[model samples]
Target: MSWKKSLLDWWGSAGYKKCSEKNRSVLKAAVSLMVVLFVLAIGVRAEKSVVIIDDGKELAVRTYAGTVADALAVKDIVLLNNDEVTPSLDSALVSGMAIRIDRATDVSISVDGRMLPVRTQCRVVGDLLNEAGVAPGPEDEVSPALNSAVTPGMNVVVARVVTKTEEKEAVVNFETEQKYTVNLPQGTTRIAEEGRNGTAQQIWKVKYKDGIEIARQLVSSKMIAPPVNQLVMVGSGLVVSRGGENIRYAEAIDMVASAYTHTGNNTSCGVAPHYGVAAVDPAFIPLWTKLYVEGYGYATALDVGGSIKGNRIDLFFESYNEAMRWGIRNVEVYRID
Candidate 1:
């Protein structure tokens, strides 16, 4: 049958006319059901919700209009060099889509007060400082020791020390009063002993002024040589004896601190070649005063030079040559300050 004739013939039939009211109602219901099915089949659809992880943060993109790229751009999610994403930007967004972005960045860290440039994925406090070449000095004090936890900003410091040894040479002048007896008489040459007199030592109290032998008053004197009085006949006018006889006389003693020659060059009254023994003339001279001798010229006594002590002077000679030359000569000394 023709499509139009079938539709008209069905409409004119008793099934259509006798039950027209009921049929009309049923037809209306059927038409409404068909429209509802059509609308349900193809209509505005709801977009899937997309979850993207970017820069360590989760971003939700709901109602994604187009592709994954469009979704990201729509959500204002920009991709950086170190950022990572799951289901790349080109992938289409689906329902409950999860996109993950791993973000990494170049960071400069200050380790123990020292600025260190490094690349790391660490987030804890202990691992950062070890990567940087930073160490603490032994004496340097830090807020936290080497084992302490490190943070973004920390401080450190260091300390140092130096040492030295020194040596110095000082001279101390000293003296002692001494008296010796001579057998020969004054102005007259007469050998009373008939032989040369041997040298004798008599200790005396000697005073020093500023490490110098100023005045030596004899405290006591003893005759080391025997008494010898020679009777000489004078032919011309009688010779008058101005000075007293060289008889047995006692003199006061004066002692001054003095240093002795440590070097075996034991020549009395001369400079010592070495720093053997030391003494000081506390009465007049201060310790460590330099001295020069006049009668016996040379660097004889170094005040407080450790030996040549008290009134007893140290006479310096060129060598042992003149040392023996001026062996026991009574000489005057001068202070050079």
Candidate 2:
């Protein structure tokens, strides 16, 4: 107030009234410019209103700084190497401007026998894999699930699972069947039908993990061809006439026959060796059993010999010359029931 009164008094003085109109106009213009400069200075120093979103948290800030970087610096917010910032740091600050910061997390991915270390801002595991350029197949197995939240230092594993169908062919064995008949000679057998092996197909489901087999299951089995059963005809018994006598027997055996004379040794059953007596293995024919020979006459089993085994018989002859003459022959033996 005192300065304004003094300046007004001097301007209205008689000496000052003598000034020219051009000088007065110059003075008025100078005062107006001074007032405008003061107003501009005040506007430049005014504070700006801004909002900072740091890791999903909103912070309302009134900053006197000029740029976004300067505003964050004022708040002592430091940016890391992997951190993401929007509305870049160099941009000029404006009233009500929004600055966002997305924090990155460190994680590791294990896939296809590889370890990949990465830093990402993705929150979900699936999104992190996508960002890392790792794609999982439909049948692949993933650890910690794709929808789970991503954590720091987490290790994600992907296992490749595969399933395959395998077909194999195998041989099917045939069965044998026996049929009894009295039409054929005793101890004789004939094949009525020949046995044949058939073919079969098997289907298996095999599962593999990382190129290694994990499980195998048989899914189906089908016969390609039915097997043929073998049919055999076996002789039960027969009646035959030898030396004008009819002999009915239960079983017959085709055996090798040899002749033996007296060796000054009695039979094992304490009987003197004589004609119509045969030496046989007790396992094949019991002692004192009735028997008939084809080339030789009927006889009884009264002795045993070490050389006489299965399907072999020793016929007794009265003389050495006769025993030599009947050296060895194949003959049919019949057991009377």
Candidate 3:
């Protein structure tokens, strides 16, 4: 049968007769009222009730004909790059729809050994790790601590600090020093012993953060090649006696001594050349001075020669053969006045 005939049959069915006249009348009035209200609601169906959540805060609001972005603008909510939204701002709004915005904050982070440019919606350091998808062990370190509050662009460091002891060898520089001694006469010094640099073995406690060396502390140090202190002996005080007379002198040095003789001619000081006359450097031992040598006895410094300059002295001997015997010899000479 046709759907039209079936509907007419249902209207005349026994079930339709089961209702009382009074009840039927009430039902009929209710149906008529519902139909009229439904038609009126269709004309104003553009308005919707949307729930907005911003940073965990919820606001139930009614909006008139616009997208989700337009609805949030009416509430003066501005979206930033760090802010997040569910169902995106461009999506159309529907009645009784939930719009969630999880706002992100700029945060600094150091993971492992490197600093990271990060932005997250986490509110605490502990939550930050979850947002970063990092699970820290008991030995790992966290800056701003794990339970501390997090703010925008705050410093947060996660380090794995480990310690170990190590042994190392190092060089030590030797020291050079002087020693005053009365054994040697005054105004002379000599290096008694040469110094050699030393070596040492050391134990160090080292600290590494995230596999990078952070610090080291000396635990123990032992000398391997002990440092040798250079020793210099300096003369302190003295007096000497020579030529049947007591003489006082500041110092003595070696000199190249030679001999020249011309018994009859005069010397540079107008004194005739004699066995005791000595041509000496006036700058070192002045003319007309009395001096004594170690091997060659006493002499008078009463003459000067062109070749006699600085630590050089020409002595007078009785004969040329006698002078030739003393060709050149380093002799210790004393200064006496």
Best by lDDT: 2
Residues 95-201, model 3: lDDT tens digits: 88899998888887888767777788778999988877777767678888889998977988888878889998988988988655555667689899998899999
RMSD in Å for model 3: 17.7
User: TM-score, each model?
Assistant: 0.27, 0.39, 0.45
Sorting all predicted structures by lDDT, with the top scorer first, yields: 2, 3, 1
At residue 217, what lDDT does model 3 achieve? 99
Instruction: Summarize candidate 2's per-residue lDDT along 1-337 as a digit string, tens digits.
Output: 6755876788888866887999888877876886688776665467989999999999999988878899999999999867988888998887889999988998999988889998888889899999999988888888979999999999999888889999999788999987555556777899989999998999999998877899999999899998999998777566889988987665678989999998999999899999999999989888887888898878899999999998889999999999999999999988653
lDDT of 2: 0.87
On TM-score, the leading prediction is: 3
Can you tell me which runs of candidate 2 are displaced by over 4 Å? Answer: 1-66, 69-82, 94-100, 168-201, 222-337
Residue 57 lDDT in candidate 2: 99
Of the pair 1 and 3, which is ahead by TM-score? 3
Model 1 lDDT-worst window of ten: 233-242
lDDT of 1 by residue, 1-337 (tens): 8755876687678767777677789976876786687675433245668777775677766773555777777877777653456777787666777777666444454434345555443343334435544443443333344455444444322222112222222222222222222222323343223323333334455543323454454444445554333333212222212134222211222333222334555333344544322234434444444433333322323334344445655443335654565455444433332
lDDT of 3: 0.81
Clashing pairs in 3: none
Stronger candidate by TM-score (2 vs 3): 3
